[model samples]
Target: MFDKLKEKLGGFKKVLGGAIEEKEQEAIKAGHVKPEVSIKKEAPESAKPSETVKAPEKAGIFDKLKAAVLEQEFIIEEKSVKDHLWELEMALLESDVALPVAEKIVEAVKAELVGTRRKIGSDTGNIVETALRQAILKVISVDSFDFDGFVKKSNKPVSIVFVGVNGTGKTTTIAKMAERFKEQGYSVVIAAGDTFRAGAIEQIERHADALGIKLIKHQEGADPAAVVYDAIQFAKAKHKDIVLADTAGRMHTNINLMDQLKKVCRVNDPDLIIFVDEAVAGNDAVERAKLFNSAVAFNGSILTKQDADAKGGAAISIAYTTGKPVLFLGVGQSYKDLIKFDPNWLLDRLFE
Candidate 1:
């Protein structure tokens, strides 16, 4: 899924390894080590016949010298580490990582490189690998959450509002969440709050029927917040555990639509407002997430079509841009495609 991003990071690793190797070679060539000459002294030029000179005992002197010579005895500072990191930073940007996130990663690598201790004339690949892993972990783990734990601990009728631009699979993502909650032994209800779209109600109705979950709706052009309120009431009356509300998809720049979302937030006071978007949308998705967060302050996100997104940068950038964790990823069209986002799992996918 993240093939492109993995390739990009691999490139960075190659550059970093090369830079460290070059610096180590430079240190070795600068004669920053003890020579391999023997410990025994030459015979005296005069009076060799009359004076008897004691020869020093060879008590592991050669072993000690070998260890000293082979040891990374020299320390060389590579000032050009910045240059390599700069290339990495550009590569990250090209992969659709946000500018701020990319810069932070580069700075982190730089900090780990400059004036750091290393064995002279030895391969520094492991060192560079560690630094790169740490940098990426820092960038993506800045904001994270435990979704299943949170859902389990939350009060009954745990409401989750789905928000995003049109055609980003908002309603389907809600249906997937409904299935997930149901699988967890929770009674689920779906609120078809997207009244602006012509076929939104029918679309959600199909999912509701298939999942055997109750669907709450009003009509086309009806108030989305009112639909959510009614859904909450129905969940409460029927002892349902969760309410997955689907809001109308609107562009971030639409003032009227954004205001409508604000009203929904004010009215329903949902537990978790999740932003849904396409994984392949790249920077557009990131900008949309930022704008949506600014408008209604979403809790996290669910990215759809992750299987098709080779670069897979939106998954990283969206969290960093909005100061929120990615709750889940929609890998395919099936209900089982909804995979929870785990930072460690993602790290292994990229680094291993």
Candidate 2:
């Protein structure tokens, strides 16, 4: 899903790993640190070098003690590390990460590089990889909720509203959500609240037919809020456990439409409002999410078309910028392609 992003980040990883290895080797050649094979073998007092061969700086007892203290320190040149980190920053930018996000990534890598304590002869590559993995996880999945568990614990007929712009496959994401909930043994009803778009009802209807789930709808150009309210009432009567509402796709700048969305929120009172977007859209998706969130204060989000996403910046940007965890990813066209979002799972895929 993030092939291009992974490719770019892989180069950054090599830069960091290589820089650390280079510094360690320089320390080795300068006799500041021992080789790995000799690390566990301490120099015996009986085997101490003759005075004539002793280093001038360690001739005095206090100097020897100072050298001993310095030997425990692992120093990485900040200037040199910054050079490598600059390359990393550019790589992240080229991967379509937001400028702020890319900067934050570089800062994270730099923070891990400087002032770090490493065993005298440990593998620098492993340390670099571990530090980078941790930084990325911190950026993406800072605070998370278990989607399935949260929904399962919610009250009966819990409403989940989907919001996004046109052509982001928002409706399809809702269908996938419905399919997911149904598989989890929660009876679900889809509310076709996207009354403004032509053929929206038909689209949801087809999915409902295929999934054997019920669809609640109003006429074309009808009140979306009314459709959702009706759906909730129907769910109560049928004892359905969940209501997945599909709202009309509108640009974030459309004041009237955004107002209508607020009215829907007021009337339907969705438990979770998921902001959907295409991962391939890069910062545009991120901006859209921010705008939608400002209008409705979204509970969380769902990213779509992730299987085709290459730059993969939207996933990181949306999470960090919104301070909300991505609940799921639409990896493919099939209903089963919806995958739960996990920060560590994504890190494994990104750095594996």
Candidate 3:
């Protein structure tokens, strides 16, 4: 996962490491910093017998030399940081990162590296990796929502509506959520509110049957708002722990469809509205998320096809673009493949 982004970061590390090493050599030559081997002794053959005294050299000299080398500080110049960041910015853009997001990461990294102090002989790889990871982490750590905590503390029969453009796996994500909720000891009722698309009702029905959860749906051309309302009622009557409503996929430009979605929200007043999109869609996904947020004001997002996403720009940009947390990531096709979003989890994959 995120192989392309990872590769680009690795390239930057190598570039920075080479530049630092060159600077170190130049500093040594110019007498700005002393090299570790500066304290040299005469060869054995050239040493006088008396000077070469019988006793071995005291350990104090060696200790002091080691301490001096460890205490030596190497400064990374600001110009060097700026020079190397252009390549990284281009690489990020090539990986489908938004221009603003790429610029943010680059500036963060530059702040971390420019004029930074490091001990001489420190691992250059570690230095570069730390800067890059922190930069990426800062870009991704937007306002977060704790899905588990919310479900635990909210009133019983938590109602959630899923929305997104078509072919983004919005329906499957609902089933995944239902399975997850059931595993956590919560009864789930699914509302097949996607009444516009052909086979939409049957698709959700198959998932509900397989998961052994009750599903409430209407005919193909019925009003979706009615279906969601009925599902909420069914959950209340049966004392179910949650209601997962699936809405028909519609582009943000489709004014009529968006109005229909608003009606569903108005009537049901769900506890949360989750936006769904594919991670591989890149900048397109980010833009869609922004437009959708403007349309419906969703609470959070769930990114699907995460496993197949090599660029990983969508996952990084969506939360920042929408100002909403990414609650979950669909890593695979299985119901169990959905993982809660975490900054460290993504950093580990990029830097591992």
Candidate 4:
């Protein structure tokens, strides 16, 4: 998928290999290691200047080096296909796949296709494509929450609670979730459980009004658990299909606030606990995930601000570290910007 990035990285392999060989030769010549010889094909006449000249072709050194490296012949059962797979691996690593993770993906790809016999006229590209898909599947671990599964298994009044530290988009994500559920003809209600913030209740109310959904809120500085208890009871009485509760965004280190969140969970008994986080927060997002998981026992994750996060490391790392399935990714501020988690699509976008 990330063909351009792969192509760029592929050009560096030969240069790096040559540098390693030169260093080894220097070590052997200096009596630091035993001399070892490996056969290397000679460069073509066109690649090696026949006679030393003051000025040759005006191509840059990188272009000359690439030409010299390409002159040597190497036997691969499927040269083109192998090259393409190698490029994919490089692109994955460049896109924040840790070294160990990248190595595991490469190993999986090799095991799946490298030694397999194929028909003489068959397209090796197809085999490589299969291997790449399998490799991505292995790294991403797609056995998690399924939206279709949820639709079938969940009963009406599915209660979902949003939990996270402050500034992680918890309140906005609740609005987006409400919008999504409402579009599906499901009656959705939002509970402004974030009673600590002065404007939090009004903010959620504003979204509820805009979406034409019911909102349950309390006065500022009221107990969060009490707010959620009232919301759940209200939703139950009204026969609402879903209840999205937004919790106060407090630091995980605040023991008192963490206990308060636990109380909210205890009171609501939500069907799902989604931990909202900012994708651009990087490693800090991972830390917050850990804290929220400990505080309210989160079931899954929702990453926000992905459109602005170039590194995208938080999504992968948070999922892996927390063992929590990522439920949705917020690409923009619009309601439609929230995307359901698709492992294959995510990998394609990340590497691309």
By TM-score, the better pick of 2 and 4 is 2
Note the Cα lDDT for every prediction shown: 0.78, 0.79, 0.83, 0.67
lDDT by residue for model 4 over 1-352, one digit each (tens)?
3333334333433333342233333333444333333323442356443321122233432222111111122112333234444654665556554555556666777677543433222233444455655775675663477754685478877888888889888888988988888788788878889989878888888888988888888889998888778887888899888888898998989899898888888877888888999887866887788778877778888999987776655665566667777888988887788988777886566334
lDDT of 1 by residue, 130-162 (tens): 787788778777565878888889888899899
Clashing pairs in 1: none
Candidate 1 overall lDDT versus native: 0.78
When summed lDDT is taken over every stretch of 10 residues in candidate 1, the lowest stretch is 61-70
Tens-digit per-residue lDDT, 1-352, candidate 2 = 8998898878766656655555555556667555554332334335322311122342322221111212423545465466667777887777778888888877887787675545556676777777777777778874767777788788888998899998898988988888988888989999999999999999999999999999999999999999999999999999999999999999999999999999999888888889999998889998999899999999788899999998888887788888888888999998998989888888888887
Candidates, ranked, lDDT: 3, 2, 1, 4
The C-alpha stretches of model 2 lying farther than 4 A from their native spots are 37-73
Best by lDDT: 3
- Residue 229 shift from truth in candidate 2, angstroms: 0.4
- The weakest ten consecutive residues by lDDT in model 3 span 61-70
lDDT of 3 by residue, 1-352 (tens): 8999989888888767755655444445545445564333323344343321122233421111111111245556565466578888999999988889899999998898776566555677788899998988887888867889999999988999999999998988998999999989999999999999999999999999999999998999999999999999999999999999999999999999999999999899999999999999999999999998988899999999999999999988888778898889999988888998998999998888
Tell how far residue 83 is off in model 4, in angstroms.
15
